[model samples]
Target chain A: MTERLTLALDAMGGDHAPAMVVRGAEIARTRYPQVDFIFFGRESEISPLLDRMKKLKAVSRIVHTDEAVSSDDRPSVALRNRRSSSMRMALDSVKEGAAKATISAGNTGALMAMAKFVLKTLPGVDRPAIASFFPTLRGETVMLDLGANVQCDARNLVQFTVMGNAFARSVLGIKEPTYGLLNVGSEELKGHEILHEARQELSGLNLPGRFHGFVEGDDITKGTVDVVVTDGFTGNVALKTAEGTAKLYTEFLRGTFRSSLLASIGYLLARPAMRKLLKRVDPRRYNGAVFLGLNGITVKSHGGTDALGFAHAIGVAVDLARNGCLETMGRDFKAVDRSTPDEPAQAAAV
Target chain B: MTERLTLALDAMGGDHAPAMVVRGAEIARTRYPQVDFIFFGRESEISPLLDRMKKLKAVSRIVHTDEAVSSDDRPSVALRNRRSSSMRMALDSVKEGAAKATISAGNTGALMAMAKFVLKTLPGVDRPAIASFFPTLRGETVMLDLGANVQCDARNLVQFTVMGNAFARSVLGIKEPTYGLLNVGSEELKGHEILHEARQELSGLNLPGRFHGFVEGDDITKGTVDVVVTDGFTGNVALKTAEGTAKLYTEFLRGTFRSSLLASIGYLLARPAMRKLLKRVDPRRYNGAVFLGLNGITVKSHGGTDALGFAHAIGVAVDLARNGCLETMGRDFKAVDRSTPDEPAQAAAV
Candidate 1:
């Protein structure tokens, strides 16, 4: 049997919380029998859902908390006022060493703020960054700073690259993940001066991964690199734009299939093939975004995800814990130089 | 019969040069009989191609220029040298009032620089912006500042909105286009302070279009607004990312259809329907990107496009010139205040 581990979950977090959270845990428990859970939420709402899943109930415990972070609550307000909220309590469990990791599908900003405040940054890290993996042509590529810092300097970007390198290597199990700095163009002279500075620093790095220099937005889907690093603003926009384009493509295909009688019959014949296509690109399979560079593991599931999606998110947290992701990153951090690369006086010289 | 108009063509521009340029003009002439062309390039190369199309040759004139801007030339380098090159001479035709507009398929940076130098900005305009239209859920939407200015202040963005408004009204034929400032989120406090400042200034404007406030990257495909305005860096990245996503979708679909025998048969049966779908979203149909806010109209065709795509770009130039796009923008510029709005002392006040 595999070694047992405990994960603290924010039960009253998502859109269909408590029920979705409990059911998801039940599903996860089947795949990871040795894993236990500590659900943080209102006792009245969660206990009944746990009662329905006898197998999950056998391995789970509850930490009752009436307060919950709302989707509309500002990050600062939620952090300051909702100390006893389910999200906060779950994070606290990880901080206090009662749980190996924490998972939440609550307000993203609130979760990030609380996680940063509670768990704090790991050694030699300037700021924590959000990282997520998505399906790509070659396989999967991990991208960082999805919505964390709006504006980042060369030093911040270099730090993000380091964290992303660790995440891709440890959690994703790539022996030597390649890193790319996301920019408007792939040329050395293209984009802002900060990108150029970051490039200079990245080129001189002694990390295990190969620094791929600059990559354009399209390189993300092409799987040109194992890890993509960018500021939170551009990363968020690119992620959302890709999502929207996929939706548009689906809509177009649907309209085309329904436009004629022959097309309708063709759709029926291709239903199985279409199902395989849909499964390959299912958003549920890639539902978790982890806050990297934190003292402990914190995975944020999509807020509107169902049981299956939440279960996938739980799997992500389990994978990170089992793989000793924190330990891997910690060791890597110590080996690398932590000081910010001094800005070159003459940018044109680059 | 429509009033006759003349357009200058950079015959040596693009990957396929004089051959594609001449053929594209021939195709364009069929749709626009009232339009005439002045081809600028080596007479030896262009004259041979023009000789094949009698209809095009009847209404076309040639201006010999041995020098042509190479694809690898930097914008500043091309601007400083290459004065007598085909691309520069085409712009000069527009400046000298010999042609109503000019079109090119050369290096985008070179084209923008030459156009700005030769044509200059319209009265009260701070800088010229590159505007392009793409298919969306609801008809089409125009986006601007697509790599013309990488780093933009609030004042620059406000000017792009004004220029985009004029382009949609005149060229796209939208009576009152709705404008949206592209951002990471729709929330008032989501992005950089510059966005907030631009929003404040936009809200106070008495423009023709309705300001839809902030919009995310996904909104571009959703057709959430008629005009999406953003800084060149973000805009260029978002556009390329969307293109990459669309390509990825196509690849996945192709792989799915070939995975099984039944799927292959279904694809054959659905061929007609698929053709219809492809036509609706064909990149060729939306091949042109106009350099808005220039004193003279200039359209840039995709550098690697074929004759059909080049013709579509010519059509865009004709549409803009025939519709009096420059005159409309010039009139609007006169009515609007050109001064930058003072930056608010306290950002918290927004």
Candidate 2:
């Protein structure tokens, strides 16, 4: 595990390309010396940052690609015209088995699309989902379909649930991750037909993890289930809402501390624990955007991220790769088929 | 205006019963002398609390009733069986023009059911929604359909949208409340079929507020939308997620501050500002739950609430009564015909 982790850093991607990406790569090298990185943008963009990165660790490879993927570049267009782009070539490297994983901080849609296209789906995976760990009241909750597969069908959602469970167990180290459908309510008949249908489909699937019935937004915070599954729209909304509220709450708390002279001193005394908690819940620390259901490990860092964020993304990729996530997922899917082929109509009833 | 605000309090319902109800009434009376109260419940439950209430404030009347509605009781059954129950009778007081509004910390379904039965829907209003205000990062956002109509059609959602718009304006004093349909994304085409239909309906309707397209859960915290409209299930999820996350965040902050000595001192200095924020965002201060789509003003406080929470509910009721909320809603509904004069296809489509 301490051995070198070769990561193809898509330096040309992200808003603060090259600089932040290069810095993040350097950080990853120093903190995790076992992890070696390749800078994948144009030589001009990567050269200046080389000095800063030298302070942390030396880079082994520099795949010079003149092409860069702008945040605004259309995904299809990027894939078509910029086949030689750094992001594309980085994935090509991963495909060629040069790197264990490829990391990018570019347009999520484009990255996911290209990643899916290049990596392809593993056996039995209809599609890949993006699952992330959120800081909730109870504990970390894994939510899927944050921005992948927006208009998903019942089968799509059921698969999302399966992938999510596999993810929580593999990455988060949870055993038998509890899976729950994210809906407006818990009642079997409460939400729309899709979720209702999904509930039925899930009921009969004989999934590897425990099906904890349906959960709502608050349920995410309650930690009622380990893996919460939903379509990208609702899941994305829930994730962003939690993130925004966390930031807002932090801002308000700091201001409250500074308002009064005495309270200001109290805030000073409480800074250590407070900062710890803030960072604990900071969305950036959990900076991982996993392309689930894919044949290979592709992690997308936040586009507007800092050096530290990219390092975290690499950490996530390392975890996924070492954990045999794909193999485990295939096993889970096989379990579904082997356990219950009948799938009684009444078995899926809400 | 404060002097004229009188509220009828339901004593028999809720999880805590007469003690919390009597305590809440006393607290409201002490805080707002303009506020008078009439307690309706079993005489046995009210007699003992009269002297204690007198110690806090003067009680004008106590209407004796033997029936009580359980939280799980069906709305219709509760409404029928509890013909003279405290909740129904209190609502009757509001309908008969004796009190500005009736407040219940009881079964939410029964409260809405009885209110609708006795007070009736406002002209042109097809359905009523449950609405509450959330303190967001920017300022505040109003969310509706917390749990009113579980299985809402596009039409019901439209009505919820209408109610949310008026509530934001009247209660929050917001001008041209920015309305957003809570969905996964901002795209016009994204969402469940009902939501998709409602999106079109909302876009086409010439309403009082500005429809700023579809707002996601994060938009609530971003302060992009003044009114976040959703079905009861989604609304409840969003609201509860906000609530649970806020609590968890504060808890984490508290733990962080308490972890070490130096940070503890920092917490002291920042205590005033933090206290101000905690006060402003405190859930209890914004406890009153308004039942929209009713002919008269009504508020549902949390079943397990204190005097402060009840006082907030009274404050909400006072605002609605003073602002002619019922009349405004009636006028808005009049502008949009509830019953279709034609277009059977439209109704079916809706």
Candidate 3:
């Protein structure tokens, strides 16, 4: 018999918490049969839901924490007051080795703060970065620093590249993932001082993944590289912009299909094709945002995602733990010399 | 009779230049009979193309210049050596008051450098920014600093807000255009220090347009604000990401429809509806990117765009010149006090 892996769940997190979390756990239990869950939330609320899910109840145990972190709670406020909150307890489980990983759809800022505080950064990592995969023309590509560190220096970016590279290898199953620094243009002279310095260092790195030099915003969706590295601010903006544009185009198509009777009939015929297209670009399929460079595996689901989306988030956490992504990341970091290189004088001059 | 407005054109610029330039001019002539053109390039190449366009020949004058700026030339290199290039000569026409505006489908960096040198910035403006419109669910929204100033201070952002507001009013025809500063989040505590300071200054401005405070990246396509103000780096990345995402979705739809015979027939039935959707999101419809804050109205067309796209770019120049967008921008800048406010000590602390 295969050894069962334990996972931590923040049952009181997200928009439709407790119910969605319990249902999602039930679904995940069937999908990942070798996995067990430790639910952290109010026992009164979770016990009734667990009673309804027979399979989930057999493999899960409730921690019984009434305190929960609100979606609007500031990271600092949550950190100071919400020690017994579901989100914090979930992270504590990971830190204590009670769970291999933790999954939550809670306040992002608060989650990041508590996870960083409890789990700490991995050896040789200065900070943790939010990493997620998005659909592209060729396939899916992983992007990092979604909104963790707003203003990153050259060193921070280089570290993100290392973490993102490891992620693509372990999670995406790419033998030699190609990575690129996100910039205004691919030209050498373009972008700011930090980017130039980061480029120089990245170009010289001897790693499993190849650095493909600079890529623009469009390259993210074009699948120009396996990993796209950027500061938190630009990455966040670019990700959101892509989401908004996808929504806008989808709305336009819907409006066109409803304009006339003939068009409506056409839509009926094309419904199968449209469903395939929708499944390919569904946001729920890409729900989990992994906080890379952390010592423990922490996956964040979208606060507004549904039960299926939450189940997918749990799947991501299971995959990471099963594949030993944190161990692989640690090995990758150990391989690199983390000593800060002499800052290129020309970089400062620019 | 309406006073005729003249637009300078760089006939030797873009991927399919000289031919596309002349053909686009022909289309523009029929669209706006009141607009005249001065084509700058090698007369031998342009004259023959003009001969094929009879209507364009009647209203356009060709300037003889063998020198042309190559697409690969660096901005500084082009500025220093390509003095008599078609791009430079076209700007010279605007500088000499022979044309109200100039449009070119050429190297963006080279064009910006030449245009700035020739036309200079408006009285109270410190830098010129690239502004363009994108289709939104509500209608069309304007975004500025597409890729002009990479590293902008708080003051530059405030200036962009002023310029963007004026462009929306004069060109987009919005009387009281609402504007917002683009950020990672809408919260006051989010984003970098510069964004916070910029927000503070913009909130205090008693301008014609209402400041809608901070807006996230998704707001750009949702049409949350009429004008989205951002530093050039973020704006450019967001714009390109949207374009890339749109292409990705379109490709997915095409692939899905081609997967089976039934889907192919369904595509045929939906062709008319798809055509309508295509026309609405057609990139050619939004070809022009105006360089705001310049004394002259300068427009940049995508280098890879076809004749129709170039024609739309020319149309943008004509509209800006006819609406007195530059003059209105000048008045708006003059109305705002240019003095730097005392830096909030808290801004430095952050």
Candidate 4:
């Protein structure tokens, strides 16, 4: 527990890049004092920012990489051409055992492709899933396959369930998490054929977490389960829809506060309370999207996030790394893979 | 436009049942003075409720039906056995041309099933889609296939686009409404094979509204397009996710307002402005889910909505009937059917 953990940061990634990465490392250093960093980017750009933060500079070193993956680069194009890019190099650090994890805010597709190529998937996992925690009424729920595998089979969903369960136990510190498959309805007869196959497979397995069967999209915000597993297509849409609704709500509040003199006065009086609520539901708190089921940990930060948000992403990587989430998933999924030896009911394959 | 329109009501449906139906009809009577209602349920229950509202009784007549579709009844069970159900009678009225449309707050599956069997789909439409309008930043956006078809092919998606476009123009009064296919990403090559096929088909067709290509889930609330088309599964999940997020925001607001005495005073002063915001985003304002592509209009109200919400649903049916939405859709689909005669690229069939 006292051992120092090193995290690789893609210093040239995101909107604010090197500055945000350096400042974020400084903020994270205070919270996780045992954590160190390897910043990957052009030293000329990163060095200046690091020089301003002595605390981060003390435990961090720069790995020079002139090339960086552009935000618009496709996964295949980035993987083939941008081999020496900051994002790829950062992931390489994790593969090379120079760091416990990698954190990046670059192109999501490029990051995923590079991470998979460099670190590889765990023994029992067919694909890596993007897992993130969402704030709900009761607490937080971790949903996986946010946008990784668009066309997931029953096996992929089961693997996601295993990965998400491992995530909850390792990072969230839940002794035994409860998981559910995200569907249009909670009925046993709901959703695609693959979902039913996945449910049947999960029901047969003696997993660490309890399987709650099918749950609707509303169950994510209701905190009905610790983990919600879904295909990347639906997960991505659901996540974005929730984000959009939240933004719309904020806009409505702003318009309300500006409508009249009394409302303006009211906003001023309620500023303190409103600040507390804002902090509680702040997107920055949930900025990190963890690439689960990989041999090495990789966290994707929101591209437009500030230093504080990047720091949150760093904390997520640190938590997953420290808790040995990869190993936990490996062990749990090994048992599942043994029980379910054949992947016969692959609807997509048919 | 000057003709008096009649809407059939499933008076024994919903959580509130005959009482809410009678009250809602009274409210709608005031709004649409030329609209009349034929209440289908037990006359003993309907007569007593209508007696309390003289205005509703003046323009409405009760059609006694002993049987009613239970909330828990499966679609197949309801369709086979519940032949004399109030919901069935309501649809029957529409088929008999006794009512211009049917308004039901009953089981959604049962309503859709009965409506399809009684009224049938419009010519050239293989399946009907659930269409609803969402409150968006720019105004309102019409989205289709909310929960009707769990699995849809490219042809189904193209048909949904057609229905949604007609809905926007005829009901929402949007001239040349722009539409987008909901996908994981806005990129050209993002989602499943079906999405690609659907996009290709939409692109080639000379649609009533302009096709804006793929749109992410967030675009729905952003009002990026006037209409959105997706399979029922994804659409249902996204819609529910947005609703859940909205509910969470309200809970957060309530918690903030009750956190301190200053906040309580602020809330009192801000009540008027908050009311305005609430009214604008009210679920009641968007209560009706229309079954598009049907030969006749069928509006389904939220089963748990109050009198006001039910009244809003009635308004939806009235609007659709008055605007000849079914005929408009029929005309639009006829052109699409002629152009896209062969459904050769149906991935689901393969």
In model 2 chain B, where is the ten-residue run with the lowest total lDDT?
Answer: B183-192
What's the TM-score, to 2 decimals, of chain B in model 2? 0.90
Model 1: CAPRI class: medium
Comparing 1 and 2 on DockQ, the stronger one:
1
Give the candidate number with the greatest DockQ: 4
- Cα lDDT tens digits, model 1, B228-250, are 99998888888888888888888
Q: Write the per-residue lDDT of candidate 3 for residues B1-350, one digit (tens) a residue.
A: 88999999999999999899888988888999988899999998999888888888989999989999998899999999999999999999999999888999999999999999999999878989999998998899999999998989998999999999998999889999999999997231389889889999988887786899888889999999999999989998998999999989889888977987777777787788889898888888999999999989899999988889999999999889878898888888877754335434544678
TM-score of 2: 0.90
Q: Candidate 3 chain A: minimum summed lDDT over ten consecutive residues — where?
A: A338-347
Give the CA lDDT, 0 to 100, for residue B295 in model 1.
91
Q: How close is candidate 1 to the true structure, as a TM-score?
A: 0.95
Q: State the lDDT of candidate 4 residue by residue for A1-350, as single tens digits.
A: 68999999999999999898888889999999999899999999889888888878899999998999998888899999999999999888889899889999888899999999999999988999999999999899999889988989998998899999999999899998999999987221268999999999899888886999998989999999999999999999999999888888888899999999999999999999999988887889999999998899999999899999999999999889889888888899877766764544552378
- The C-alpha local distance difference test score for the whole of candidate 2 amounts to 0.79
Predictions ranked by lDDT, top down?
Answer: 4, 3, 1, 2
The per-model lDDT (C-alpha) reads: 0.88, 0.79, 0.90, 0.90
| Candidate 1 lDDT over residue span A1-350, tens digit each | 67899999999999999898898999899999999999999999989888888999999999998999999889999999999999999999999999999999989889988999999998878888889986788999999888888899998898888888888888888989999998876121278999889999888878887999988888999999999999988888888888888888888988988988888888888889999888777788888889999999999998899999999999999999999888888887776654334434333377
Superposed by TM-score, candidate 2 places the C-alpha of residue B123 at a distance from the truth, in angstroms, of: 2.6
User: DockQ score for model 2, please?
Assistant: 0.51
Question: What does candidate 2's lDDT look like per residue over A30-90, in tens digits?
Answer: 7766777877888876776686556543645788989877777666777787788889888
Candidate 2's C-alpha runs over 4 A off are A1-3, A55-57, A73-82, A184-189, A193-209, A343-350, B1-3, B55-57, B150-157, B185-209, B265-273, B336-350
Interface RMSD of each: 2.0, 3.2, 1.9, 2.0
Off by over 4 Å in 1: A186-189, A338-350, B186-189, B338-350
How does model 4 fare in lDDT? 0.90
